[model samples]
Target: MTSIGIVGSQGRMGVALAAAAAEAGHGHCGVDKDGDVGALAKEANVLVDFSSPAALEQTLDACVAQGRPIVIGTTGLEERHHYLIDDAAADIAVLQTGNTSLGVTLLAHLVREAAARLDPAFDIEIVEMHHRMKVDAPSGTALLLGQAAAEGRGIDLGDCSERGRDGVTGARGHGKIGFASLRGGTVAGDHDVIFAGPEEILTLSHRAENRMIFARGAVRAALWLLHQKPGRYTMPQVLGLGEA
Candidate 1:
């Protein structure tokens, strides 16, 4: 049985991960915010992190020091944090993503396929909603889906994407991907990718009913990462959805 250690043990995702681990018959070596992170890394077979961005660098350092694998589900990271994760992945396996739900992972894949098949005239737009407590806009998952769309259309998201438009904005530009975010209630997550054309519209969506799906997917990723060599990884690899 793999021994799992959790960071941010007191947070909502942390509690869910612990419960999911128990349900999967895995053992928890440590779960805490104040614990010796490096010690936990050394002792546990794998570490799952759903902590804050502030704790990211330190956690990556600890996992790297111990040559242990980690699955990261933290959101709202910046460029520096991504660079740090890339550096650490050279020493220890790391799987990082915005959302861990299997459905979302597959949804991203399908979005890519659809975007590739549709012409630029389809005008792709991504919309997402989360709980009011979430602070990020255009959520990490939305960006992930946008990236897939950009990849399919051979464009750069940073260069061709539009976000959070307000009044006085000009008409929608062709060949540009758009994003809209909504927050309220206790929504787990809801994402939709729409392809709008002159004649018709096609929308693809996924709604998460509970947070447990993410917890379960994170556990699955952690288990898969345990056997991988030192490198960066993604949920698509875990689910065998990589390009043929």
Candidate 2:
């Protein structure tokens, strides 16, 4: 059996991951915000982190020190965090994603394909809804979908995306990706990608019913990472959706 260590054990996602591990018949160790991840790392083959950005670096450091692989499901990570993951992957496997739903990962792939094939006249809009307790606007999943759309159109996201539009916003510009966010009671997650044209519109959407979707995906990713080489991987790779 694979021995797993969970960081941020007190959080919703972390607790869910712990329960999922138990349901999967895997060994698990949990560490809360003040817990020592380094000590826990020594007892497990892989670490799954669902903690905040502030705690993620320390968890990664602990995993690296123990020569253990990691699957990160945290959001709000900056570019520097990615650079650190890249550097660590040289020595141990690292899998990271904003969202861990298999369907969502597949949705991102389909969105990329659709964006690439559609005409420039198509205006792309990505909207996501999450629980009220979520602190981040434009949920990480929304950004992932937007990034996919940007990649499909062969443009940089930073150069062509508009987020959180306010009053008096004029007509949408060409080649610009738009994002909308919603927060409400107990919504696990919901994402929709709409491509609008002059006469017709096409949309793709995914709604998560439970947090188990994410927890299960993370566990599967951990299992998959055990067999892979020391390198960075994404949810698509873990689900065999495509090459990393």
Candidate 3:
């Protein structure tokens, strides 16, 4: 059985991945936080991180040092962290995504295709809801959808994204992708992508009823990554849904 290590092992996602790993008959090597990331990387076949952004560099450094592949489900990452992952991918296999649900992965692909087909006349907006415990606003899944829309439109997400607006916010910009977030209760996750045109509106959505789907996807990603060459990859690639 492949040995799997969990970073942020005490968190919700970590716990889910642990249970999934056990059910998959994989070895639960160890879990780490502030103690020794490098140790877990050295001992495990692959590391699964759903940890905080503060621990990202530590985990990446350890994985690179040990030449271990990693499945990063960590959210709330910055541009610098993405750059770090890209750099590390040159040495070790790395798969990263905001959400690991296979359904969400396919949803992103659909969103991309829809965006590509629609013209600039259609306004795109992404809204997501998560549990109250989630720390990030505009949930990573929302950003993922926005990224997909931007990709289809042949624009940069950072430049086109319109995140959380407050009072005095003016009219929505043309061709801009907006985001809205809601947090309450124990909602696993819910995301909607709306494309509003002159008289017609189209919406694509995906809802997660439980965390198990994410756990299963992460494990599947880890297993596939074990045999992949050094590089950065996404869930679409792991599932062979790379083509439009």
Tens-place lDDT per residue, model 2, 10-87, is 889988998889989998888998898999899888999988888877888888888899999888889999888888
Clash number for each model: 0, 0, 0
lDDT of each: 0.91, 0.90, 0.91
Better of 2 and 3 by TM-score: 2
lDDT of 3: 0.91
Task: Give the candidates in order of TM-score, highest first.
Answer: 2, 1, 3
Off by over 4 Å in 3: none
Per residue, candidate 1 scores C-alpha lDDT tens digits across 89-155 of 9999999998889999999999999999987789999999999999988898999899889889988
Clashes of 2: 0
Q: Check candidate 2 and list the clashing pairs.
A: none
User: What range of 10 consecutive residues in model 2 has the weakest lDDT sum?
Assistant: 235-244
Distance from true position, residue 86, model 1, in Å? 1.0
TM-score of 2: 0.97
Could you tell me the lDDT of residue 39 within candidate 2?
95
